[model samples]
Target chain A: MINKESVIHTRNLSRSFGEILAVDRLSLAISRGEVFGLLGPNGAGKTTTVRLLAALLQPSSGEASIAGYQVGIDDQEIRRKIGLLPEAPGLYDGLTAEQNLAFYGAMYGVEEISQQIKRYLELLGLWNRRHEPVGTFSKGMRQKLAIARALLHEPEVLFLDEPTSSLDPQAARLVREFISDLKGKGRTIILCTHNLEEADRLCDRVAVLNGHLLALDSPIELRRRIFGRKVVFHLSATKTEFEPILLEFDFVNHVEQIENKIVVAVDDPDTHNPVLIRALVEAGAEIRFVGELRRRLEDVYLELMQASEGIINGTN
Target chain B: MERIKAIIIKEWREVFKNRFVFFTVSFLPLMITALPLVILFFTGRSEDFAGVTTADLPPQFSSLCSGLDGAECMLYFIVTQFILLFMMVPVIIPMTIASYSIVGEKTTRTLEPLLATPVSTLEILVGKGLAGVIPAVVATWVGYLLYAAGAHIIVSNPHVVNKLFDPLWMTAIFVVGPLLSLMGVSIAVMISSRVNDPRVAEQISGIFVLPVVGIFLGQTTGLILVNQEFILWMAGVLVVLDSILFYFAVQIFQRETILSRWK
Candidate 1:
């Protein structure tokens, strides 16, 4: 039986290929029914981490588990419980979409595999053309079939590596929505992708990894902790008059007013935003709109990569 | 066992769907078999072709002729010599199938998803190995059977038929043919695992047939005689070699190698 807590657990898990350390001393815990994202740049061990946890590749040292089964020892067991959509959909061009799904379903020992195949193919909007060879389908359709193959066994954990990397915007949206739907069913998912926006929207907690875990937190928490908080307030009155009053709070690092909008950078917007709002209203500045101007997850990701580089260069 | 069966079924589906591989595996043996018959048909009809007598026949050819006339002796010699060419079929057909199936999967990037499954490496290799070997074996036997029946019809002399259907040729085509196919599939698989290009694997695997060609050359040149004893001994050697090659083929087929090493 799978552990109710921490469907995936790792302790200092590391893997090296000759001189190159693909994944280094990684440790993490992902609870059941959580959608965790592994955010990384190319060659940052994101795929390697997924492969390691999926039991496709064994770690050189340390230990890891999927659904309470040890990675190396219970590799077949772990594989039995996990599904993977690799960077490439890797479907056989000669086989039909339904045949491809049936092949994988049989390999995973999925019972009533034809029904499972039909279910996933229909869910991905591929039931209409399931009999057509995958080679005849577009890239997005092939990817959808690959996704269906991964979920055919109804695996306990799903690992998606760059699920929408080469897809067009509309196709990407379909795959993202499908992933969101999977999350709604309380499925445990580990998505490794470079798309920060998708990660932000889907992942409950994103782990920024570059060979190791650099930052692991909710997207909102990561932005607040790394870049601090900046709240933007638009007022009907000219905001130049409210700057001094907003700066009175020590947590407010800087206050800038551009026409009728006040942009305040604060250490903690959750605590200071309300206090600043009350003062703004008390002073009789007509507030038209009040909202937090959070930093984009992309900016946070780049900053983290740059800081990690600085540490690697011994300049920090 | 079911996983292996699934892989084998998928492999057959893929092989048959590929026109070039399917044609090569199914028709190449027939083409090769036709080559010798065409040569025999023309060699018998050509005005310049002088029929050799029993005294003029080579020592290796004389044994097959035994009590035949001069023209019959010539046809007997031709039929026996062409059987050596048939051996190349098992090697060529299976090598073509195995190299293309293994390396073609790599080129298509389909191997990754298959590797990610819990199917053991042994099962995958065996499944693929049999998929290639079965068709080649059947083709070899089928082509041989066709050639034998055609030779009986085309060659009027009974001596030619007698030499073509000898126990030695029977063992070579039926027993040694499948073993050579196994060896060919194993060598192709080993090369396929190391290389990403199917063409490269196919070219390198062609080297496995050089020794068989040497035997062919030796027998035809009267340097080494091919008799029933030689056929039985060769079968023994091939069965042992096939087992060893297959064992190595399985050992070398690492899922990690396919997943990580090959780009």
Candidate 2:
């Protein structure tokens, strides 16, 4: 179902090159101001999906609309409403940083081009070097300039493909901070990346794709759906005797004992934990502490990718 | 229109900075214009054609130079020969620039970002086309004026100097020169779209100049005469060729093909 509040909507969107399907039967609705991530390994159609949504490439099948404008039909309008930072910085090395922004700003028919160029240049910390040719810039500087160019037009939607792929740690952090700042401005951003950590930190929801939609949800929710919630109770002694007691509770799905710790898989850890602790304490148990097992977004991403591979292998 | 202007301005900024492009646009026209003037200066001061008459001239040029002295006829023939060389200015200069326009953007990986903008494909092609044509046409006209001024100073015969302003040369420089530049740019744009290397595109597009060179050869060998009718016919053919080449260029420059298929 299409959400009326969605800024970007696609249904059964498929794009293929010759016999190889790059994106297959993918459907998604990205609401306004949401940072949606497209995550997958190489050859997973992440870039292709961004290109399709940006209206740089035509979809082989299905429909997409961005900012209420249909793709393929209103491509120029869609282009006007969106900004794309391609994988490569793709700057003109011969032109100065200010000239680069001025050219793109004019292409978008941006008013007060100089002011916009100054605003983004200062924001990206490249204002002092605006007169220098891009060829003289470092890799990090070029990436920052490219970002500024994308945002100079104040686009309603921004598509960033691997915005921090090649940067050093410090540069990457700066870019991440910039993206986070944009998030606060309530502009819808579609980030295509394989950086699970980046996605987990920046995305409200992410779609794991491998030429097809594998999974889509918030990082925490995907972890919960894949691994379920587990509460670990640290006991004062050997925990073998507490496993059966925890399993006796109907809310506890499964229980395992390992080295003075009772790991209980429960549906609702918040409410079930207190009741389980009470039962364990009443049954002559000494619980040292209680904590919920946390899974990283990396684990969730790996599990989803493994399961996708398994299904493909099983079908073959 | 603003988008097109932006592209044109962007292209000029980049093209002006390129050393090879600057050299070709500035020096080639000056050289073409000067070489003929040097030839006329030296030949006018020499004694080789001092005592010659209409009997000594080629049969094709004998009647054309009947009223002129030997040196005057010789100077007139030399100047007419260089007219086709002036046409070469427009063809070669634009090919130098237009050949690199699209393919250079591809090698630099800037085409994707440019295409992602709201600018239409036609606007881009037109902008790049004009960027290449304007300089070449302007240089050709300027070089012709320099040659005209230089010829009048070097040659004492008024009739021979007057031949430079003939309607044929006027039409060829003013009308045919711009068309040939457009034709060259269109072919370069088309070749640039399909080829991966700008040098390769330039080499292939350079083949278009051979026909003009062949005409020059034929004119010098008395096999073909470049008359007013010939200039008009060449302009007509260029108009048709430019139209066909531009249509194919737009068709081949599809956004999907460029983003996906360009290696």
Candidate 3:
């Protein structure tokens, strides 16, 4: 559950572009020290929400605050608390790695900007090429410089958009590690990404924002609440027509039968599995493997998207 | 103040770093000084391009204006035109620099992080205006100096240096230059704050300079006389324009609107 020490609070926030409603009354409280993930498909308003929180956009209606400051009115104070890594942020192609950092640091008004510039360059492993123009740096290096720019002011809240989009495996790992480090320091974070695995790993709570919020909960709560019990029963038996025999069981929701193998979903698969085995032997059908199935975060994500589509069509 | 200083320093470095910025700033000054030298070369050490040598010029040129001769008069024409041309640069730099200041960041998608900083819209505007204005004003003086040096050498008149500096030109640079620069910076910044597309902002911001150029043409064609009274009147008019520009530019710089439309 989102707690009382929320750094960001949005109330009935809505944005409409002509007839198109981009964000519809999006209201949520993000507590301090939590990593909140905003997951949605392309054009699902994830990016819009990030921009709103960053005080970059004027809401059509409603209100939002960062660190107790209103979005637009007290913009400077809000900006002080939040740092954003914008989507598709480009590098100054003519500036070297160190120069870019120094430029941003100065713009951010980071104290001892030169020292911070050195620290960030070294942290991102761009120390070796600190003098090389960002145009000459690799994609991973550019992204790293952008991140350093984000952190230059040491903001209390961070908004990371697709933070690991272009990184190599090692680089992605380093960013993830850095995020964990930030969270450990009690800094709030808002992340917009499609990486389901990363979401499961890094976030404390995730909101599936399709058009409106389809679901909002911790990953574990979502998985448990959305998907019922998954029971995988392995049955080996005579290969003669076992598929039809398995379908006869009333409790079976879906039955996929392979030659001498089957996967079944039932309200009570535990009770149903035994009955299926007995029926199979009676019918002289072969029974193969039987056990519980493993459910993944992907399944939960898809189900949430579908549920949201239903929500849009006015189905509960 | 610290933030402003930081922004100005960083912006100065950026202007120096970009080849386009360097060229735009330096090209005019080099041309300004070199024109008189070219005329002297073609006219056989005669500073006057109007075909009247300093030796045969009016007594006023050789007496009231002690340093002025036939060639020095021609040199004055060059400098005056250069000053007029220099007025255009303020508008130009602001267009290029302000177009990229915020709108460029939006295009790069860096506007998000920039907006997320603790800096106010006013602070941001001040920082950006300094970047565009400083280079433009400095370039005008640098170019004028080079022109004066070339004129002094080419005129070959020992007295030319004495009249190379004029009270009128000095007043123009010190007074009108900053006013015009502020006008440019303000209008360009206002345009940048409103739009998301850098190209569109650049184009829109650029149109504001037409009136200034029109005034220059009017003066050139004698449609408007630019006596001391006229200069003072026009300066007053520009100050009013500058105030209006400053007021709306700040008002239209709605942080929420920019942030929202920016995305």
Best-performing candidate as measured by TM-score: 2
> Please, what are the lDDT tens digits per residue for candidate 2 over residues A1-316?
2223889999999999999999999999999889999999999999999999999999999989999999999999999999999999999998999999999988999999999999999999999999999999998999999999899889989999999999999999999999999998889999998788999999999999999999999888999999999998888875348777777778889888888888899889888888998998998878899999998989998998898898989952
Candidate 2's displacement at residue B260, Å, is: 0.6
Q: Provide the lDDT at B146 for model 2.
A: 90
Between candidates 2 and 3, the DockQ winner: 2
Could you give the interface RMSD of candidate 2 in angstroms?
0.9
Which DockQ-derived CAPRI band holds candidate 2?
A: high
- Per-residue lDDT for A274-314 in model 3, tens only? 78767766876544556766566678999888777776789
Window of ten residues with lowest summed lDDT in model 2 chain B: B43-52
| Candidate 3 ranges with C-alpha deviation above 4 Å | A1-4, A166-170, A233-292, A311-316, B15-18, B40-83, B100-102, B156-161, B193-225, B254-263
For this target, which candidate reaches the highest lDDT against the unseen true structure? 2
Candidate 2 local lDDT, B209-228, one digit each (tens): 99989999999888987777
DockQ (C-alpha based) per candidate is 0.68, 0.84, 0.49
All candidates in order of DockQ, best leading: 2, 1, 3
Question: What is candidate 1's lDDT per residue for B22-62, written digit by digit as tens?
Answer: 78776788788888888777764323335556677675666
> What lDDT does model 3 reach?
0.73
Candidates, ranked, TM-score: 2, 1, 3
